[model samples]
Target: MTPELTRDCQTVADRLRATGHRLVLAESCTCGLLAASIAAVPGVSQHFCGSAVTYREQTKVQWLEVDPDLLSRHSAVSAPVTDQMARAVMRRTDEATVSLAVTGHLGPDAPAELDGRVYLAVCVRSGGPGASRDGRDDPYVVHAHALRLHEQLRVQRQIESAREAWQFLVRVALADI
Candidate 1:
């Protein structure tokens, strides 16, 4: 792993540990690089719940429950899909208090408009009064952003995306929630 990626993972790991938050992920385009990066951090298992690598539309639909209509409307790499992925991943893992989802088109064969574009979403569970229909106290606060990668090589793009994802996770973990 690159030094920058290691540092990013360390920062995210530190923040999650400080906050007592367990993280889970749903990934595509970058595949499982984000999870792998975090896994490199020592004692990461204490804060990481695991990841769902939903690289295929069928898997995204069946595993993360991403809406087929949303996929048809906005494509798999869109912000809406990542938003759903972030929230749904947390639902799948009872131990996770935070979820991160990333999707992108980083390839030579990607559509011109979508090439090098990535979307990321982070969801944090918080307690609030009457936050759910069943009167449960837990509610989620979600944040989503887009990234444009400048790397020309696919492998470089994946590495850069994973590094960027770790940085995003640090920000989300440190945020007031």
Candidate 2:
């Protein structure tokens, strides 16, 4: 990891520890880089639940329970699909208080418009003072973002995406969201 990314991971770890939040991840184009970066931090096992690398559409559906309609409508790399991926991952693990999902087309084979486009989503469990309200389970509040990488190489794009994910985590963690 780059020094900046390492710092970001550490910052996220520290903030998560302080806020008593645990994290899970769902990944696609960046593969497992985001998970790997988080795992690099010492004692991360306490705050890090796990990650799923759902590279294919089938896996995204089977593993993260990403809706086929959303994928068909927006593609796996779009914001809606990524947001649902985050919510699904968060729901799958009781240990996770926050979930981050990333999907993107970062490749030489990607369509021109989507070649370097990536979508990231962070879902934070909410409902203050109660697990449920009005007899319904608490809902996760999701924050999503879109990014375009300037890198041409697949590896470079992946690295850039990973760095962006870490940075996003830092922002959310610090905000206690």
Per-residue lDDT tens digits of candidate 1, residues 1-177?
888888888888888877778899999998999898889899989989999999999999999999999999999989999999998998888778889999999988999899999999988776422133354544688988898999999999999988888778777655455
Per-model TM against the reference: 0.92, 0.92
Locate the minimum summed-lDDT window of 10 residues in model 1.
Answer: 127-136
Cα RMSDs, all models: 2.8, 2.1
**Model 2 poorest ten-residue lDDT run:** 127-136
lDDT over C-alpha atoms for residue 98 of model 2? 85
lDDT, candidates in the order shown:
0.87, 0.86
Best by lDDT: 1
TM-score of 2: 0.92
